[model samples]
Target: MKFVIYKDKLVESVQNVSKAVSSRTTIPILVGIKVVATDEGVIFTGSDSDISIESSVEKHENDQINVEVIQTGKIVLHARFFSEIVKKLPDKQVEIEVTDNFHTIVRSGKAEFNLIGLDAEEFPRLPEIEEGLSFQISNDLLKTIIRQTVFAVSTAESRPILTGVNWVIEKDLLTCIATDSHRLALRKAPISINPNKSFNVVIPGKSLTELNKLLDDNQEPVEVVFMENQIVFKTKNLLLFSRLLEGNYPDTSRLIPDESKTELTLQTKEFLQAIDRASLLAREGKHNIVKLSTLTNNTVEISSTSPEIGKAVEELQLERVEGEDLKISFSAKYMLDALKSLEEQELTISFTGAMRPFILHSINDQSQIQLILPIRTY
Candidate 1:
């Protein structure tokens, strides 16, 4: 395959698709990126079986030609070397030409390199997801939903299902839930779409994390297509495919409390900063635990103690405190994560009791919620 591509455009597309190429793949060919040049434009594909990414550099977009095709063909080059070489090439443009024997040459301003390429025919084909179930969501909103929940997915592979985020779409609302048994994150967003379709799919947390990195914080819509075992995300010039985990995601609806016995409203940033300071001492402790107690003076006390080191105590003034006063201990790391995901200035934390899981969310935003299981510190 022979083609001339703009260096900046090529670098960006390569960097994007490279996220899916795993260096330790058993299949040697999987270590390379497949480039296909056609009359339309150039397409780059990277995959490691679990996830696949396809990005194209079209001939013209927004009235610009990013690629000029000299000849139409296909080739596969080592992903790591090719990507590094392209990015560092000392030119504004790159010319790639492949021979019939799969020997590829890369040339730029005063620099040339030749590498053995593989036959693109051996690459695995992306699953053609027929119109099964689909939805559209803004890129920024999707990124928000992913960041809010993916952190809670189980890192332990003992129960593989818990390693993925469960997505449930009904009517105009989409709900995303993730849990590691100790804590949970749930986010809901209303999206406009065709009526009468509901979807339940468990996508790996790793996949969602990758997708998050690929998305730009824009208002453009991302089209999602789900088949029996695969989910595809379509953007302007990119297509991302992830295999769905096989198993029923545990029902987490009942775990979230429907009512609270004690509720406290505090500034989100204030609470976050208090936890951040308290965690320094907690980090020295074996369990990294912090104690939170609602005080009678409309303040929440954040404290942590380590037997061998020291202790930290800080008070954060609250906007309001209601119901019964409560004292709870939980992982400071979990609390910080929940706090970082909040896009609000004020937050409300609801505690059912000192023993049960407590909930944290934006004061006026009910669509996003974070729950933390208390740590036993007797």
Candidate 2:
């Protein structure tokens, strides 16, 4: 294969696909990136078994020439070397050529390097998911959904299913839920889809995290395709494939209480800041617990205490408080994360009781919900 590609564009494409490159793999060939040159453009692919990424540099884009093909072929070069060499090249453009024996040469300005590549045919084939159950979501919205929920996925591997974000698609509405037993995040958004289309899939949290980095914040739609065991996210110049986690995701709806005994409406930022300050002392505690109590003055006191560290206390005026008086203790870190995920200025936090889980939902946005189980501190 021989092609001349714009250096800046090539660097970007290489880095994007390299996110899927495997650091440890039983198959040695998987360590390299497969580059394919055709009349249309040059394609780059990288995979670590669980996730695969394919990106291309078109020969022509927006009337500008990005790549000029000298010959059409394919080769697999060591990603560690190829990526580094591409970035360090001293010219605005790079020329790559391969021989019949899989020997490759890279040139830029006055620098030229020779690399031995592997046969492209030996690389595993990417999954061909038939476009049956598919939908489109805006790039920014998709990233928002991921950001709001992925953080709550369990880091523990004991319950492998909990390590992923559960996606439930019914008609045009898509719901995403993630929980680690102690906390949960749920987001809902409308998508472009057929009314009869319904799907429930668990996508590995790690995969969504990586995919989020590559997605640009724009109104451009990202096409999502669902298959039996794999899910594909297709953008203009890229295709991302991730294997769905096997097993049924627990029914999380039952965890959210339908009613609340104590409801408090307050400024999201004010509460978030107060908790942030109290967490200084809370961090020194065993479970990083922060205690909250409703005061008779229609205000609330946020405090934390550590036997060896110290204590922190602050009281903030609430917009409104109703139902019952309450005192609850929860992880400071969890509270901060849940509050940060919200974009609203004011939110309502409802407590079923001191022991049951409490939920935080924005007054203006009912589509997002954050629930956290209270920590016991007797």
Instruction: Estimate the overall C-alpha local distance difference test score of candidate 1.
Output: 0.92
Q: Please, what are the lDDT tens digits per residue for candidate 1 over residues 237-330? A: 9999999999899998888999999999888988899999999989988779999888878988889998888889988888899999788899
TM agreement with the true structure for every prediction: 0.98, 0.98
What is the lDDT for 185 in model 1?
98
C-alpha lDDT values of all predictions: 0.92, 0.94
C-alpha root-mean-square deviation, candidate 1: 1.1
lDDT by residue for model 2 (204-260), tens: 999999999999999999999887799999999999999999999999999999999
Please give the RMSD to the true structure for each candidate, in Å. 1.1, 1.1
The regions of model 1 sitting more than 4 angstroms off are: none
Q: How many residue pairs collide in each prediction?
A: 0, 0
